[model samples]
Target: MDLALYHPAAGYYTRNRTVIGPRGDYFTSPSATPLFGRLLARQLMDFREEMGYPAGFAVVELGGHRGQLRQDVLLEAPDLAYQVVEVGDPLPAGLVGCFLSNEFWDALPVHRVRVAEGRWQEIYVREEGERFADEMGPLSDPRLEAYLDGLPVAWMEGYETTLNLQAQEWMVQLGQCLERGFVLSIDYGFEREEYFSPHRPKGTLRCYHRHTLHDDYYAHPGEQDLTAHVDFSALIEAGRQAGLEPTLFTDQGRYLVGIGQELFAEIAERTAGQFSRERQAIHQLIHPSLMGSAFKVLIQKKTS
Candidate 1:
């Protein structure tokens, strides 16, 4: 699964083709409106000020699909130094600025498992009649065993779950690469307790195709996108162990409003004479029903 999504030869991202916006499988927040990137830019500016205005700062964005956010940042702050580090790109060392991602970790391939007979078993995908089918195997990873053991009793009997140890490893790698800076992660997730609630027996794994949500992941193979719900608590714990301090945790709506509301208001007042599409774009971004409430932002700073 990991090879299919990340292999340089035939990977979804490495194909060098446009795969974002309405034309693609799904639309990301940055692709929807520049306001999302603008708000993030505001937070980056705040971080710069906190760091006493370093002579040179790097804003590294991972999984920057089509570089929309990077383009928006440059448009908003042309003088700021920015870098778009996509999958398979080498992360630079001694970075001293903000590292950002939008729905990146969820895209990483995860091992699926189901608890039966008081033990977790691996769920494998096999090609069957031109489609993928679920195949069960013995759980070999010690970490997967440990993860299942930590789940609540309610989730132990014939319930499926995703083990995203790769996400944790990615955090470890990023932590080591970042010398003194902040890691800003934006995604949809729930805290550990709420994440494994009894209501969610099947886990949060979904596929996106033509902007519509579906569970048939094998329908399109490499053509569609697959994602799972992030475990924010697990990420937080991993970051803490990697020497990164959990500085802030808030829903995307609150974070954006707290930082961008004043700027948005000022812009609105100044541009009241012309009710343009830009104003409409701003509304969509901050609207609670839209990307605002659906996403979340997690900020962790590395202790110098």
Candidate 2:
């Protein structure tokens, strides 16, 4: 999965910046509106002030492609130092400020697992001839095996799920990087209760191609986009283990609305002249039936 998405060359993210937006496989929140970043900037400024207004403040953005969020955030608060953290690039070393990402955690590779024959097992991917195939085998990775030892998921037969082992590791790294700051993640997912619910027997692994969604991860391999819903509950626990404090966990709709309704109206008028397209996009970002309820935001802060 890492080879398909971050192989340094010919990978999905490294080569396909154009594979986003309305014509692409998916449209992230930042790609939809600058309002998202502006709202973030407002909250960030408050966070910085709330932390006693440090002199050397910085905002670091993770998985920022072509610096869209950076651009939007900078446009609002240009005087604030902004940096984008991409693959093979070092995050602001020991920086004191905000670490943010939009739809970032879901893109990372995950280990697929299942329960069969009343025993836990791992779904290993192997190449057969010119294509890849899945073969069930005993859980080899001890980390994943240990992670699920006491999770909320019921031990039902044939229940499938994914574990993003790297997410927690990265959180640890981020915790060490920021002496004092906020860690913000925005993506589509649910807490442990809903994420591991019984209804989603097949798990959240999915593929996207030309705006169509598919469940087959082996299709087109490096040609299509693969994603899994983030387990926010796991993320919160991991952050706490790394010594970070959880501040807020909520959906994107409440996030935008929590900022203020008047600011949203001003952004709609200032950012878009036609008003029709931007209005629809804003609705999609905040309306529950659209991206609102589907996407959630997590905030973790480190102080002291």
Candidate 3:
């Protein structure tokens, strides 16, 4: 999965592919509208004010490709310092600010797992005449077992799910890097309960190429975007262990409405009963049937 999505040569992301926006595979909120970043800028301002407006408080964004959010946030808060870091890059040390991410966690490669005949097995890829095939084997890493041991739910035979060990590792690094501040993660995911529910037997692994969704995980390797629904519960637990405390957990709809209700209303009035792009974008952002409910926002604070 990692090689298919992040290989330095031809991976989906490292090769500088058009993997986002209307012209690409998927549309992220930042691509949906600038207002998303404006509201996030407001949230950052609120965070800054709460921290007594600390000097040199920076905004560190993980996987901020093409700087869409960066441009929008900077346009709204010109005085702030913003830094974009790749997934595997070294994070700055002793920072005093927020660690922000949008759809970042979901993009990280995850290990596929399933309970087969009362035993846990890991799915591996194998070469088969110009194609890839799944090869089941023992857990690739011992941590996979440790993660399963921590889950409160019982495993059902043949039921499958994913474990995002990288996310936990990143959280540990984030906790160590920030001397004090907040972590705001926005992505489409679910709590552990729903994430590993029996109803979702096939798990959330999916592929996207030019906005078309399919389950052919082996198709067009290194050319399509691969993703899985994040486990917010796991992230929250990991954050807590890393000295970050959860402050809020909500869907994108409520979070945006909480922060930008008046702004949206103002835009609606200015449109004067005609459907403008601004209003349409706003609807796509906060309406439940759209990207709103599908995406979730989690905020955690670290103080030292």
Please provide TM-scores, in order, for all candidate models, with all chains considered together: 0.93, 0.94, 0.97
List runs of model 1 lying over 4 Å from the truth: 153-156, 270-276
How do the residues 198-236 of candidate 2 rate in per-residue lDDT, one tens digit apiece? Answer: 898899999998889999898876777999999998888
Clashes of each: 0, 0, 0
In the order shown, the candidates' Cα RMSDs to the true structure are 1.9, 2.2, 1.3
lDDT of each: 0.82, 0.85, 0.91
Tens-digit lDDT track of model 3 for 193-269? 88978788889999999999998999999989999999999899998888999999999999999999888889978
Hey, what RMSD does candidate 1 come out at? 1.9
Lowest summed lDDT over 10 consecutive residues: which window, candidate 3?
A: 150-159
Model 1 steric clash pairs: none
Cα deviation of 98 in candidate 1 (Å)? 1.5
* Clashing pairs in model 2, backbone N/Cα/C closer than 3 A: none
Runs in model 2 lying further than 4 Å from the true structure = 151-154, 265-275
lDDT of 1 by residue, 187-265 (tens): 9888888777777878888988788899876776666678899999889988887778998888887887789878778
Quick one: best lDDT, which candidate? 3
Runs with alpha carbons beyond 4 Å of true place in candidate 3? 150-155
Candidate 1: clashing residue pairs, number:
0
